[model samples]
Target chain A: MKGLLPRLIKRILGGIVMILVVASFTFFLIHLIPGNPVEAKLMQLETAGVTPLRAQIEVQAMYGFLPHQPLDIQYIHYIWQILHLNLGQSITYAGVSVTHLLLEAMPWTVITVTSGIIVSFVVGILTGVIIAVYRDRGISNALTLFSTFLHGIPQLILALLLAFLFTTIWPIFPFGSPYDAVLTPGFTLPFIGSLIWHAVLPVAAYAISSYGGWALTMKSSVISVLGDDFILASELRGLKPRIRIGYIARNAILPLFTTLTLSIGFMFGGSVFIEEIFDYRGLGYMLITAVGNLDYPLMAGSFLIITVAVIVANIIADFVYTAIDPRIRT
Target chain B: MSAKLTDRSQQDFGLSPEVACQVRDLNVTYRVDGRELSALREVSLDIRQGQITAVIGESGSGKSTLALALMNAVSSPGRIASGRVTYRGLGEVTGMRGEELRRIRGKAISMVFQASQNSMNPLTRIGAQLLDLARSHDLPNPRAVLREAGDLASRMSLDADRVLTSYQHQLSGGMRQRVGIIFGLVLKPEILLMDEPTTALDVLSQSSVLEIVRSIQRERQLTTVLITHDMGVVAELADRVVVLYAGRVVEEASTAELLRHPRHPYTRSLIQAIPRLTGDPGDAKALEGQPPSLASVPNQGCVFRERCPYRMDVCETILPSFRFDGDGEHRFACHYEEARHD
Candidate 1:
């Protein structure tokens, strides 16, 4: 107990240090891509009768950074902005701050990722335990086979297939935005309904693509727990089926939680694919545009969010795991 | 005294013919790969009231199957095919099912599993598990059950508070075994079946735990069935010993008499296998040949013929019927006796 605060401090310090390293790496690595956003924009402005030097100045002015500066100085500048919680302006989104753009787009991703995770985790663990309890049954074997098949399908393929099927063939659900453009955005029923309606496909893609893995992992975990001596002893102790199954699920669900949290960060990264495919205007979609336009601030900002998220989720998993499993509490 | 129990000799030996549980022709079978294998065939024995009856057998012997059968708990593909476990107060245990069976499991005939270290729910504290058991049996005062558990632990020379508060892993193996006993006895059940209680413990822990079991059994006058392969354990605790060979009870006698004059060839070999420091080193002959597995037991003859030193021609085909001793407390099944032996 005396070491708890120190341990927490060490963990949070490690996370911060990791985020800084990732930021510097992202900043420098993107710069190594040959031409800067200024160079890319300069060509377009050059054809508009602007001088080469003027075009460079205009593009630099847009993001408010000297693109020609040395790598170390720019790294220091990026770190300084990060320390101030200010990710500089987006070169592509012109006049918008990278922080603002991310904040605006984060919700859509959060909604889909969180919904996908909750649905999949609940369904996955539920199915995992059910199949494990009835492991010898034909239904369990068939369900297990189905889960394996679904889990093997790549996320990209799943997303693309979902997008094609729903938007092209069914056309019942809308695409290209988080909600209907006709309705004014508020706490209105129509707005929320459309929001949920739009999320179905992307969320489906995430839930379908990843739930199989959760179910399979959870299945093995549950099966092992079922075979444990305590389970038989529980029966000998005359523990009710409800109590027995609850204990089984409790122990079996422990390992999957770490995977669940770690997936949150990966879900953010996955947003680049799902959000783009569904045209959901989430952080991932903005990141794609930032990469295409070579928007240094926005790209660096997106990568930073992902790195920090993963690090934070990992830290949470470590703490949560220790809390849940008494054997590992110390 | 009643004519049935008029023999004070049996009473003086701390046992009686008053059977607490009469396992009559219990046949438990396990079906593996579509083939039914006999785990326990015609395993009959009397667990006398207030007597520790040790079922001694090799690993493959159906000691555990008989113990579980007392609770009427044979898992799927393995079941009590046809049997009547007439538990004195509870009537036929084999006839009970579902809720009726579940309710009496801990409250009437509790079981302390083999290597009880693994028998505890790892996630919960010892107290919580006790409360869970109490709740299941619908015991009104769960707090009293917890107190009784603490008291039981304290009496058994454990730190009661620490033991109750701690999880299963936190407790030592010996402590966990003791805790397992507490779970069984907390409901104050008349019958306590301990399956190899000391198997997973060190020699020191084993003795201490054995002493605890001995003291507890007397304190509550529990009708116990200690299932173990170790003859030393059988010598130490059992008032009566039932020697099981390949799922069949080959001999049943008072522990003293059985150890002194083991009539069955299998029982003789088992007793001989026990190493003693005082005896010549070569005098201890390790029993040759494996104990018959569930699938390998002969269908038409004596199960111990393969491992018996005195193998005869008649032993090959016809099964031997049980023959009684002068005391009638001693009974054995073997074709070749040579004489009355002792």
Candidate 2:
């Protein structure tokens, strides 16, 4: 128990360090983008015919958009404000708090991406096992070829293809947003049904796009694990096929868990093309808008949330994996 | 249960032969890089009931292949090309399939692999692994299986609860080996196949494990097929010995007879290579050159001709068939059988 507590503390500290690294990198990268919030707002004002120089000065003062401080100082300030849950107001969506914007979009992104990852993980792992079991057979080869094909097609291309099939060809599911605007926002059947109906294409696109990689990873890892001495011993024991698979998967699934967690982390932030192609108002959609308008506050806020989500997911995976594989417990 | 009862009745009537398993002209071959390599060549041997028969050979000598063949658990690319491995009255294992083969495997015949410690599932707890094995064989009561396993552990002088509950990584190598042996023996198998169980252990642990195995074999009257290269280990535990060279049985005799009067030259060289603690150090002669590769072994001659000191002209063209020494039990595949018996 004493040894375990220290290790647990160390793992959490490692996760925090990872998040800090991600946050710092995103902060610098966002700053490196061409224009500031002041310049963006000034252009918007100028596009409306009157160049409000005084209004730009007030906007700069309010948003801390002026280049009075160095990049590192601004980063430290940004981190400090983030620590206090103050992500500042967005320049892209006027009068909207970046924190508020994130909170609103977070549910949609989390629901779709989290669901996609879970579905993909389950399906991929099962298919991987089937592939491994029948590795020498034609079916295994055909499935492997198909998965490789799926993995090769770019995410944007996959989303567009899926959108075309579901929206244009079949016209079975809605594609514009998370739900129909006519549906009342409540815990009612119609609202939930419409939400799912609208989420189908986007979620399917994300799930199908990533499932192949997981399947291939699992198949290869399981194949290697099948050669392990323990697996051979299990065969000698004349264990039933299901029991044998259970033992094989127990060992084979450890390395895959690391990738599974990483996918969960990446999916939360990297579903940019999926959201845009679907016209879904998720965090990925907001991030695209923030990047387009140079909304540093909004971009940093969304990136920080994603960084935290990924790090936390990985840390949880570490804990769960250690618990499952006794070799790793120590 | 019916099989166990029948075995007990046969022993009671004194009709059950001593032979626990019979191997007739068994040939195991491995296909590597589109070439068929003979791993075991027409290897015929018997595992006597209630005795330790050690198949002593160096690496790639097909000793492990013989062990796998006995269980009919030989993996793909390596197969039992010809001949039969009969598990006494259980029928031909080579011809058996599915449940028929599986029933005899873990229940009647169990094996302890080389470096058997690595053969344990690291992800599983020791107790769970034991329970799973026991339950797979249709041991109805989990508690009874645990109790029986605990009894076996204590009999082996291991801490029953501690060894059972701990994971594979948590145990020492010796403990792991002991667990593996216990796993092999837990179902009360009539025949046990141990493939270098003590080769990787320290001297103390090695001797202790061997001692425990010997005692267990004696108490249970278990037939054990021990595969090892260590002559000292063979001398210590084996009742009878079969010496293999390039996947062929070079010699077979009672351990005492073979050690005293080794008929085959390869067997003689192997015995000479053992460094005696009290004997003259000058007597320790290491065999020259590498052990023959399966792919390159000449099909029509003595496999040991390249290394044999007394290689005759006939040894190159004709493979020496087994020539028996008076009693017929002691046999050697060498043309110069009567040249020297001392």
Output the number of the lDDT-best candidate: 1
Candidate 1 lDDT, A79-174, residue by residue in tens = 877898788778777878788888888788778888998898999988888788888899999989999999999898999999899899989778
Clash count in backbone of candidate 1? 0
Model 1 agreement with the true structure over B195-301: per-residue lDDT tens digits: 99888788987888789889889988899999999999999999999999888989999999998888887888888888886969788878998987888899987
Return the interface RMSD of the candidates, in order shown, one decimal each: 0.9, 1.2
Residue-level lDDT of model 2, residues B133-249, one tens digit each, is: 877787778667778889888977799999888989998888888888888888888889999998778988889879988998999999999999999999999999999999999
Error of 2 at B301 (Å): 3.3
Q: lDDT tens string, model 2, A182-286?
A: 888899999999989888888888788888998899999999999998889888877666778788988888898878877786687557889988999998998
Candidate 1 Cα misplacement greater than 4 A, ranges: A1-5, A38-68, A182-186, B1-17, B277-282, B338-342
Model 2 per-residue lDDT at A19: 72
RMSD of model 2 against the true structure: 3.5
lDDT at A232, model 1? 88
Q: Which portions of model 2 show Cα errors greater than 4 Å?
A: A1-81, B1-16, B155-157, B338-342
